[model samples]
Target: MNLSLQFNPELFRDPNRFCVYVHGLPEMPVAWVGFCRVADVLISPDAYASQAWRDTALTAPLISLTVTDVCETEGEAMRAALRLVRMYQPPINLRSGPVSSRSGRKVMCLETGVTYDTAAAAARANGLFESQLSVYLNRRSTGKIRGLTFKRV
Candidate 1:
């Protein structure tokens, strides 16, 4: 969705929904994809204007701030964003924070002995947050959370 300069933030008033922001063309060669609430970026003018890349792309005759998907939960939006990141492999997304690393990490459930091709896949199948899985993998601790143990494979 194209966001106009004077667009009303109320247009995306759902505080609970997660907004997926896409740079460049929505179809292909997406420069970046990140998810946040409307208040985080849209409602707050300072936050909205902080993304210099968005302004640069808009002035460069390219569409910026395309809202690709509005997910019910942050986890769902994250999963969708990770899927896009993997598919497009956009270079600029490395600056989008930790979510950018969800592309190709293999995760195995120590308790269930199930290995997932990607952290996103593991999170989706097990109904866990990808971020939580990342923490377990990064810490390399034997402790378990929610009775589930994970390790990077």
Candidate 2:
């Protein structure tokens, strides 16, 4: 989905990519507006205790943004995001725009809690899947959770 983020930056256009930070609602920085991008998010096996499937998907609870909506500056997006984190309680899955593309590089992933669903209707009719977005938070993960930035492996 092509969406407008709170803040548009030259760096975002770079293939190097950027990061989106999510926090607990109660722990939001201030007033946060939400954003969505198609960037690839990282997941770790011990993600929320190996709960990647639900956490990364729209099933996880809401989180706080780094910025607040009250702030209308360069980082206004960050401020808005922070406030959002403070507002929403989680187990809510939040997302940005669509996936960003690079010349020949596959985006790296860092997911933790991973769930699998083949039939969205069947999963939900059984009171299993929450929405048509077939997803769940039940799986075994042996993945790694990277830090905020990257380093040579």
Candidate 3:
């Protein structure tokens, strides 16, 4: 989908109407879908103030938002959104629980040449937050921090 067309302000001008927005990568399965007032999706102080939603949906450059439907009432929009969710089977749906990228995987510390049973164990031993360790692991670099490097084994 063309981001230029999707982000067009004119498309989200209605304040009373609810819009169903799908968030996902191009050519990949839809990761998330939901309905909200058009104003909630727009970038403004009073609206689009959800840092959590923005962090999950907008932080990745490849992620796109497509307005699939618009409804006059919230119930209609919610039903439509539920229908889409059922059809797409998005893995990122709210009911699926949090997705952990490195929870169970073994992580090897390059500096110590020792492998921990899980990322959590490695992070605990290294005095790093699991989230911080996840960031390093997800980066394209060598997953280095404080002269130590780690990799999934």
Q: What tens-digit string does per-residue lDDT give for candidate 3 at 52-134?
A: 54564555556545444556654464345445433433322222122245454333233323333444454466455442222
Per-candidate Cα lDDT values, in order, are 0.36, 0.28, 0.36
Looking at model 3, residue 100 earns an lDDT score of 40
Point out where model 2 deviates above 4 Å: 1-18, 23-35, 44-73, 89-153
Higher-scoring candidate on TM-score, 1 or 2 = 1
* Span of 10 residues, lowest total lDDT, candidate 1: 1-10
59-87: candidate 2 lDDT, tens digit per residue? 43444223212222323434334333323
Question: What lDDT is reached at residue 145 by model 3?
Answer: 25
| CA shift of 30, model 3, Å | 12
Model 1 whole-model lDDT (C-alpha atoms):
0.36
Q: Local error of candidate 3 at 62, Å?
A: 5.8
Q: What is the C-alpha lDDT profile of model 1 across 39-68, one tens digit per residue? A: 333233453455664455445544444443
lDDT, candidate 3, equals 0.36
